[model samples]
Target chain A: MEKIYTRPSYIREGATSGFCPGCMHSTVHKLVGEVLDELGIVNKTVTVWGVGCCILGAGYTTHDSFGSPHGRACAVASAYKRTNPDEIVYTYQGDGDLASIGIAETIYAANRGENFTVIFINNSTYGMTGGQMAPTTLVGQKATTAPFGRDPKQHGYPVHVCELLATLKAPYYLERVTCLDAPNVLKAKKAIKKAFQNQIDGKGFSLVEIMSNCPTNWGMAPLETLEFMKENTLKEFPLGVYRDKDAE
Target chain B: MEKRFMKGAEAIAEAAVRAGCRFFAGYPITPQNEIPEYFARRMPEVGGVFLQGESEVASINMVNGAAFGGTRSMTSSSSCGISLKAEGVSQAATDHLPIVVCSVMRGGPGVGPITGSQQDYWQATKAHGNGGYKLLVFTPESVQEAVDMTYHAWDYAEKYRNPVMILIDGVIGVMMEPIELPDMVSDEFIAQNKAAKKAAYAPGPREDGRKEKHPINVSDGGPMGRNHADWMKYEGWKENETDVEFYQTDDAELIIAAYGISARIAKSAIGILRSEGYKVGLIRPKRVYPFPTKAFADLCPKKIKGILDVEMSMPPQLAEDVDAATKGAIPMEYCLTSYGVIMNRDDIVAKAKEMLNK
Candidate 1:
């Protein structure tokens, strides 16, 4: 059977209108859509917008959208899956949304073996909130809030999502991909699709952490955002698949 | 009906399970652990869900989630646990989530003794959440009503979409008795109940073979946000406004305000007073929140020289309401509060003498 672009996803018309041009949410949504479409699990899926930028992301998607509190998407989805045994659940979160606010949710959902997928978009800054320092911000990186560069003392350290989540047993798929380059973009798409497929097979929690560029929030032009990803972000938060239970 | 034997706490738990409860979450606390213990095995046997939560906070929130998930969810606590639960309970009531909370009365203000005490009346009837809301608060005197109302509490919760509490004093939850479990909603029949429930509140996934996500919900509980106006529509359901009962208020010159075991004890005291030619009667509102004010219209105040309220809460909460609810009627008098047995007839007789002197 042939795969379809427009399936039963709730990500429908004009949701792209809600975001500013060059916003990464659309790219992330596209990756999510591409996966759900190819896997043929779009209908059996429920999506949670893990606070922040995707608060209204539920309105854009064609899948079932549940807007989770800043960090409670995974916890809510945990109970959601337990109640609806046959359904697939996915949580879309940004670094600030998942890593900082929802650290408990992020770690525990993976640790509990909850049958779901989480697409973590790491732009290294709080995009919707005007480029604040995220838990995933490259150490010593400068942003609007951390204008003088993030200090290891007062500002703490940047977290690595895939590395941190990799330690948990709940996840069947764990990967870090990026949209900074064409090939990385393609890999991130494949990773997103794989994560969703893993969930459809009842493989438990899976996460695809995408290191993407936030040109506007990074106070850089679109091109600089990509350059910055390579020069600064990549050096600090490297991109790669960190774990795969099936491969083991 | 007459002359039945039941342990106060067991009857409350059994009555709830008998009354179509399908979900329960709890954390064990002394005196009330029997509720979770009683339902844990029994619930699974009847195809229900039960989880001993990480803490009282989790237990209450989990029940809140399960209630919104469309099942009869309940939680139990003693004094300290109930305090930790104030936020969740208030949220549940404001959201009008039909949840049943059983508070097995224990000494309070901070991990006091685990022994029996009826000190939570203020928490139950007063508006304590983020909004001006009340509960479908029921006080059960006997084990039979404890069981019967435990089931009835679920129905009332659904009917009003509010938190319904069975405020059982320690004496009630701790005392043992032979409780008759009502005919239950059969396992197959539960499917029908669930279907009906899901119809009213299910958040569907999507039509295209994808699960539809129903946004996590608060039926009406929260800050004045998305559904504030929609929640206001439940105004007619404000417990105090649309519900009630009557004592011998028809020809009585004076009435006593009381509820729960205090009322049962008051009835005995009132009977003794009446025989001695005192025109006094016990006015117990079984539904404490829906206080039967209508029955005492003129008698509310400016009636006679004597009206009394009874309770077992420390220092006396029942007496305070008798004064407030009556607008200082006949200069309301209190029989005092001592948790052990609701009343010492001799002590109540002394208080009655004080009220009559006025």
Candidate 2:
């Protein structure tokens, strides 16, 4: 019988990912690898790994990979692309890495129009750190640090990264998508591909903010977490293209 | 090359280009601003990249990334800015990435002053980062030496796959002096250097054409193994790379231990004391991290009266190293200042006389 599915060639075979069960990080990593393999740029691509649950993603791909300290992936990726302009460069950052500690680097890289792609996984809570409150944590959401649910007065509000980055003039594309279900996962793949294509086309600065689930951190089963993200997380971080200069 | 009167900061930037540096990312800080300014105009001309990074933190990380990409990369900042870059520097050390960091130090302890200061000696020689990883620190006493040291810094960095720091002060950074610069490195040379180290760089196609599968994370090999390997690298550095320059140290009665601008001032005091029939010597450490402990051990404690540790910082940071090197067999005295004050040769002379009278 002919095989109906196979792992992307760009993904390392038999290497185990360290992402927690019920986490969306591995799915995103697989999608990114598939996209890179499809584009035939795996050898020429360099991925900057951010400090988060996805940090292990560096070892999962066949591309050259380097890790930056928490929240500095964009800054590091900018240097990689600037110095090696002919190569493709991208950063894989989590919400805490991009929206919090690395906000300055993320914003400035976008403003400078650095020709690169950013795959931002917004899973609300800091997954690797045991579900602590993150910048993208929704109001009334429960976290390890927010035992009584996140309060708008005390913990402030969830950051809409797509909206925030969309305000920048230099970014060629900015989109927010989710992977709660099969259909949404397909949409997220398309968004991620577009972001990578923007960089390939020499368009400056493209980011796809992926609304992801953290079932282990969210204290729910995998299926329950998907439902919760579809019902609640999607309302706060609605999935759509926030900005596309090409559409203009 | 022709001897040209160049400012210390400009000389360092030019030397880096001549050393085949093709990527520079730095933020403007007092005393070292001229470095980034010079590179801004010069890098493009040499087909290299010069970026004024968003902050010292970002700039250092950028240098780390460029270094990982197989390019000769660097960053510059003063003391306070260097403090901000400690995390990135530590990361680079952990990954064994080769990058040059130019710390043209101003007074610190928290932006204490913007003028020249040797307050960062302790920071550079020790505690540059957590994990106890040592930097091969070069303290240049003059613009010419600064240029020469900056040129060779990349080679040492790549040789060990470790970070190398060129430690200067605001005085040398802004001061102008005549210097013969190194020959310009050809683009071909830069390309060859990058190709030579391609295996160690990221996105690697290994020698057998297999893709690299392991992430360059320091946390690999568990905590114990990681720490052991990290220190092994430092041990290798101390064994093979320790360097110092001696001036009349063999027959001298008193030896002056100093570095950077303070060493220059100490040299002047040595000359003045020698003219007056005093036998004073200078032990200037070109590479401070290895700390030249062997050189200090080689000194005859029977002939030497004392070690005079001179610096431009109060509570004399260099004295700590001097005391350790001499193992308390020979007494050490300090002629020190802080708050961005330049070390005066006359004060050093006075201190030398006082130590002799004792």
Candidate 2: deviation at residue B18, Å? Answer: 0.5
Error of 1 at B44 (Å): 3.1
Task: Going through the candidates in order, state the TM-score of chain A alone for each one.
Answer: 0.92, 0.97
**Docking class of predicted structure 2:** medium
lDDT of 2: 0.87
TM-score of each: 0.79, 0.96
Instruction: Name every residue pair that clashes in candidate 2.
Output: A64-B203
CAPRI-style class, candidate 1: acceptable
- Compute the interface RMSD for each candidate structure: 4.0, 2.5
Give native contacts recovered, as a fraction, per prediction: 0.33, 0.60
lDDT of 1 by residue, B217-239 (tens): 33234445535553454444543
